[model samples]
Target: MNAIIVTGGDIDLSLLESYISKNKYTIVISVDAAVKKLEETGKLPNVMVGDFDTLADEKRLEYYAGLGIEIVRHNPVKDFSDTELAIDWAYKRNITEIVIFGALGRRFDHTFANILMLRKYKKLGVDITVVDRCNRIYVKSNPFILEKRLVWGKYISFFAVKEKVFIESLTGVAYPVENKYLDNIENPSLFISNEIVDDYMSVIFDGEILVVESRD
Candidate 1:
């Protein structure tokens, strides 16, 4: 089943609307306060997962239930964050290719944590991505291709999540670099902001690579 995940980050309604309009999916999982954003967009998520710490009042919780939204509650002190729980729930349901929204443009720690969660899910063999108005982020451990689209972000950064990533080729970008090693924990900027120039671009990595396609 196709699914979309919304996390508790500052959301861009325009981007969210456009994304949902293009896809026909059975579920949209809202993590934490992201459920409110989904409601503001006039779209109710099929399932909502969070601790509800941010829900100021019981009435707000009732409002969600009144909409027939399935709410999954967790202890605020749990080990996994709300976003991780939502992701796990999706995985268990055999949902493939989850597009995560509202995971960027928020607290730096949350943003970083969510990105790491994306990497973790990469091991589970699910195609996951985090999207916002200006960027689309994902992690890859193997070769992947991106078709020519105008760069959404002013810059594109790639960091080695594993040990090393060997970039095979790049095109249609401003600072195109090919066959380069994106070493982990050291010299992380080697693959930052390499633009695209042609109809397509490709990368072959020996280890995991976190691709952050961002705009200014």
Candidate 2:
């Protein structure tokens, strides 16, 4: 089972609802502004977290409270983002995989910050994915395999989150790489827009790389 977090980002309601209906999500967390959208999904969150500063439907929270949904409100001046706090809540309960929607919205700072969480939670032994209408982003360090059928979209990209990333081989894709070291600052676009040509794509890498599966 996986957990899903809905943040205050631009999301497709139909897509979100379809995902919820098709998957087994033990926990559903709606951040402040996302509460309104969550309600439209016809599903109640297991818990709601955030300060009400950006809430769209403030009154609906009370309705959720009346239905026994746990409200984990935090102070507006807190350090961590509401999404991060919600992630912590799930992690404490032993949920290792988390999928977040609405994270890649208009706010570049928030979107970048959410991407960084992929690295942070990875260190804490949790896999976090930030997904939206066109992209699914995550961080990977170890050698991994991506089966074509399981890939999120038509295009796949890799980025070096750190200063440098050494990829021994990137195979089973349209552009295969061998013994290549990519510099984050210099060659960030070198690994973007590759397509899986075989049944599976495999990557052997030495450092952390941000993996993006996107559709145009």
Candidate 3:
């Protein structure tokens, strides 16, 4: 029902393992250096996607090849990043739900780009989420249901990903808003630090916005 893509970024192994155990048939993908982490953790990925530059060990490469995992190598000089390639591969396979790990790290530019990729995948009708130890990030352009159990904490924030966003309404939350208008270019603090009160929270937006469910 979902695909887990691990990139060459800082990740929490315990959290990653919990996600892997949640789905029965989760397609696991490793990108470059992440392959080493997966192999070390005894969670061999089903597919490997990247330029192979970050994957320096030849023996490990051969080992995965022997295991018959799908390896998609691209040129290091390519246009798109390795994570984007992995996302595209999952999109082509008709995998609607994709959970990406190890995508948030020291490289601020890479993290920002990966976050923006959420918009592209959302437009393709694919539900993609970037998950790390402290936060779960996604882009929402339509109404979405958020189970309280799934929220990282009581704190959830909605920020306009685009220049402007039309918020239809927010329900079942502590600081509920009705028919709110948010424009990042004009005022970036329109919606900030909202809390969920009920068992579930519903977010309805007419335009694209970044939703961050985070915990301290």
- Top TM-score prediction, candidate number: 2
Q: For residues 102-172, could you state the per-residue lDDT of candidate 3 as single tens digits?
A: 88999999999999899999999888889998889988877889899878865898898778888888998
Predicted structure with the largest lDDT when compared to the true one: 2
lDDT of 3 at 120: 90
Sort by TM-score, best first: what order?
2, 3, 1
Report the C-alpha lDDT of model 1 over 70-181, residue by residue, as the tens digit. 8889999999878889999999999868999977775998888888888788888787888887788888777777765744665667887877766766555677667777
**What C-alpha lDDT does candidate 1 achieve relative to the native structure?**
0.80
- Candidate 3: how large is its RMSD? 1.5
Poorly placed runs, candidate 1 (over 4 Å): 150-154, 168-178
Ranking under lDDT, best-scoring first? 2, 3, 1
lDDT-best of 1 and 3: 3
Where is the poorest 10-residue window by lDDT in model 2?
A: 52-61
Tens digits of lDDT, candidate 2, 9-110: 889999899988988988999888787798798877888989878874567778888999999988999999988888988888899999999998789888
lDDT of each prediction vs. the true structure?
A: 0.80, 0.89, 0.86
The candidate, 1 or 2, that scores higher on TM-score is 2
- The candidate with the higher lDDT, 2 or 3, is 2
